[model samples]
Target: MAIRIKGYKWEFNLIESPEINAWCMPGGKVAVYTGILKITKDDAGLATVMGHEIAHAIAQHSAERASQMTVAQVGGGLAGAAVGNKSESTQAIVNQLYGIGAQGLYVLPNSRKQELEADKMGLSFMAMAGYNPQNAVGFWQRMAAASEGAQKPPVFLSTHPTDESRIAQNPRDLPEAMKYYKK
Candidate 1:
């Protein structure tokens, strides 16, 4: 696998939890809940999850998000500073609008964009690691089934893209990921 982990120390842990979830934190910390193992079913399936999470860390999604939030906060602070001399009600209104505008205009949209990017990169990484990227589709399918009865927010309000959307996008990503496969 040519996926570089040179600069950062990577750690992977399997947690004994019922939630079928996994994540990679910035700086290469990774956790996979045992419940997700059932859905993974095989090495390829596990690779899909690990690759996706690692891609997030590799892409520095958290750093991007933190920067974005910081910018939004600075904008809010500026706005509040400008309105410092105004009436209390005016200051309150400006702050409220800043919160809504910051989230709707940039944060939410960028979050969804990051998820798609991670999905693509993860697939490639999986293939490079000698796992068939095609197996990712089944992993996502099982994931969708696992959460079938759960409540999901509207796409606009959600941080992560829908599983169905991810599933749909997987095929488009596979050909590219296949290029990285050596065997």
Candidate 2:
């Protein structure tokens, strides 16, 4: 399926967590938590989520983030009191910049440009696989419902919020996607 959709064959593994998560590692490796299967419901939803995951690989977002973090660390080291060695203040600034201050680590969020690019790419992949791109809406609706009232929404939803604009705007891709649908 990954090959059909993303032009890359994939290998799968199981993860023991209730995170409702999945990712496509750099080398066509795919790991999907059992927890997500409930909401995926059918092949179309699974393909939607998988396509999005594959987009991360295609766009090299993970590598881009690692590069940014490496540059930031290097810059901090050169700036003054050896932040690279061990400096609490420098680490704090880096953490905040990377959105990981709360965890005392470096975490990066995808830029809005990257997010939109992934959405378009994923939609194209699903369409290429003969999944109705409209099903992407229902997939996210289920995702949003699954996260209701949580202190923090799921990480996936945190990054891909189901705002009015995103929802209303997404279906517009259907005309483009339908051209690829076989059924």
Candidate 3:
């Protein structure tokens, strides 16, 4: 990890779910799920997952989402006023729409653009860290398969870039990452 990102390092911790996951916080805080070990299966694959999540942190997606949410809330308040509906039914509708908008703007997985950018940045980070870039494909495939048949909240998947789409694009960015691959 240090090799890939100058200030980053690995930390192990327990989480409640079986989902494979990883994330990096500002100032290089990192955590990787033991469950993800099953899917990653190798250093390179694990690096792919870690790199992508770390890329998200580096890109400050969380902050961007937060900002978006604030804006959405303000907009919703204004829109709600314009609708001039204060009844229970109207309030419920507004709440529902607000929920949907919030999901799309912040809680969602990320846009296609964000996903692609993460892939590109993550691959570079992984390569610089001396991991092979080709492993990204297997990682995404495992992620897609793992997500199958799992019950998910409706608004959740609506905002996220589908795992399948990401898997397809991962390889296309390999050429760029290959330039940085260690060997």
Candidate 4:
């Protein structure tokens, strides 16, 4: 099936990995690991995953993230330089503050927004493609459960939305997404 994300001539690869991961790279390269299929369990579930990944590419999220990181790094460097005349302990404190402030004020929030955007757009895409968008909720719930015992960075430091946040928003978004469904 041709995914209709603009500016992307999609190509897909099935990698033989046990990792439950999938990604869409710049220029429309997509890869899915076999392991995630175990969780997906059905065509609609798979569509949920594929649609989300494709949405990332369609939104040019990677480029935006890189740009944000570059800006943060430059700003951090400038802040560090301005504090160079301070004592060593003061310099360390400034560095830590910069790291935390940049992450909280820009990076993590942007990432969470991107994830939410992808969720919304992916649901619409799947609905347009005749997949049931409601399945997304179940798929995400399963994904969350799967990660329950795994160690993850705190939400403020992580790039993706916590599973709980993602799941919580699905019901609210599903009604809008279903508007795109043909049947």
Quick one: best TM-score, which candidate? 1
For model 4, residues 53-138, the per-residue Cα lDDT tens digits are 88898888899999999999999999999999999999999999999999998999999999999998899989989998999999
Question: Candidate 1, residue 134: CA error in Å?
Answer: 0.8
Q: Mark the regions of model 1 whose C-alpha exceeds 4 Å error after superposition.
A: 1-5
Give the winner by TM-score: 1 or 3.
1
Q: What local lDDT score does residue 83 receive in model 3, on the 0 to 100 scale?
A: 66
What lDDT does each candidate get?
0.92, 0.68, 0.75, 0.91
User: Could you tell me which residue pairs clash in candidate 1?
Assistant: none
Per-candidate clashes, comma-separated: 0, 0, 1, 0
The digit string of per-residue lDDT tens for model 2 on 86-168 reads 57777677645544431122332344345656666778789898888889888777877786676864444345534443556
TM-score, structure 3 vs. true: 0.78
Clashing pairs for model 4 are: none
Model 3, 109-132: lDDT tens digits are 555466678888899889999998
Alpha-carbon shift of residue 51 in model 1 (angstroms) = 0.3
**Candidate 2, which segments miss by more than 4 Å at Cα?**
1-9, 14-17, 81-113, 153-169
Give per-model TM-scores.
0.91, 0.69, 0.78, 0.90
Estimate candidate 4's alpha-carbon lDDT, on a 0 to 1 scale.
Answer: 0.91
- Please state every model's RMSD to the true fold in angstroms: 2.1, 5.4, 4.1, 2.8
lDDT of 1 at 181: 89
lDDT of 1 by residue, 1-183 (tens): 335446678999999999888998988999999999999999999999999999999888999999999999999999999999999999999999999888888899899889988889999999999998989999999999988999998787788889989999999989999999888
Model 2: worst 10 consecutive residues (lDDT sum): 100-109
